[model samples]
Target: MQYYYGNQMPLRLLDEAEFWKHQEAEHTEVIREALNGLEPEYVQALKEWEQALTETHQQVVSYVETVNRMGYTFEELQEQVTELIKYCLDESLKFIDLCREIEANSAAAKDNPFAKTLLNHIIRESEYFVGIARIILYGHTPA
Candidate 1:
């Protein structure tokens, strides 16, 4: 996706990834219904996801200020961005783990296909951000 930077994001997957990541709001109903009969813990997991995502967003905003207005040295900016990336990765991994727990044994499995599909979509999005972080840390861009 043009909105994401990563070392291994395949060109063909860009549009699909963009649709899922950037346009997720359009499919809220589908997601909502998918969890209709699921265990409430799944709902709680999603709440955690929201919190994690919000925290990551805030970190990014703060880091942007540091880079733009605070006049951070290049190394300082790099360190800050790296910290932000680590925070995002840590939070995303936690959410994914929670999803796996819910998926393993819950009412969410009632519609197994839908539940798995939704989980996969979320996992892919998280992976994309992690990829960007890893690429940046390695000091290179995709070719």
Candidate 2:
């Protein structure tokens, strides 16, 4: 989670966001690979998610580089980074919903227990990231 970074707080959170978004993007492929007979619609959705997550991951990485290059988190960029964290949190929540939908409605996923388990695992991981992001954005007690 790495939430406490003193002056490098934004950098730390950005690092976490980058890693998790990349993981989540890879998770879409993991779901596709785990489910042998996934519906075309579901597969297409996962592919889109992968692309989106990857783009978000890249954005976070860019922020991380900016922070490092500047040697500290400036006020203007800090606000933007905070918004980016919020966006990442929202993206994670949406990804979780998509995973839940597949678990509940996908015919191929229903036939494959491993995919279901993987989905659950992936959802939990994303939820953890959400909790961390909330802590970073809204403090220990998020509304």
Candidate 3:
């Protein structure tokens, strides 16, 4: 999350969204792989999450390709990029909620120290993305 794209906020935000969403989708597999004895409900939930995250990741990738190819300045495409950022923000928040639920409610997650810690880490990563998205969309983060 570098502000290196001082004039390319949309590209920067899209790149971030693309990377994190892909990571999150893979994280679902990581969790699934680690917890062989996980409950069926939790496993199914993770599978659904993986699919959702992957779809979001692909959407972000499409945006990135379009933005890079079109060469539009941030001002030219701010509205569309803003909508994308908002969608990403909502997705990240929902992901954090799901991770928190697993950490708090899943017996499998509760019993495995690794899974619990990993869930916390995953939530923090999504929160970090949310914070970045807020800063970009609102020009400042709320206190």
Measured by lDDT, the strongest candidate is 2
All candidates' lDDT scores?
0.52, 0.89, 0.85
Pairs that collide in candidate 1 are none
**Cα TM-score of candidate 3:** 0.90
Candidate 3's C-alpha lDDT? 0.85
Q: What is candidate 2's local distance difference test score?
A: 0.89
Candidate closer to the true structure by lDDT (higher is better), 1 or 2: 2
Query: Residues 1-143, candidate 1, lDDT per residue (tens digit)?
Result: 24353422232122232233333332233445666676665665565555555555554555555445655555444454556555655655565576566667777564588778886786666566556545544544345
Question: Candidate 3 residues 23-114, lDDT tens each?
Answer: 88998888788866777888898899899999989998898888889888888888988897899889888878888887888887887888
- TM values, all candidates: 0.65, 0.93, 0.90
Task: Report lDDT (Cα) of residue 83, candidate 1.
Answer: 60
Candidate 1, backbone clash total: 0
Q: After superposition, how far is residue 94 of candidate 2 from its true place, in Å?
A: 0.5
lDDT of 2 by residue, 1-143 (tens): 55456777777788889989999999999999888888899999999999999999999998888778877645657789889999999999999999999998998877677878899999999998999888888877465
Order of quality (TM-score) = 2, 3, 1
**Higher TM-score: candidate 2 or 3?**
2
Q: How much does candidate 1 score in TM-score?
A: 0.65
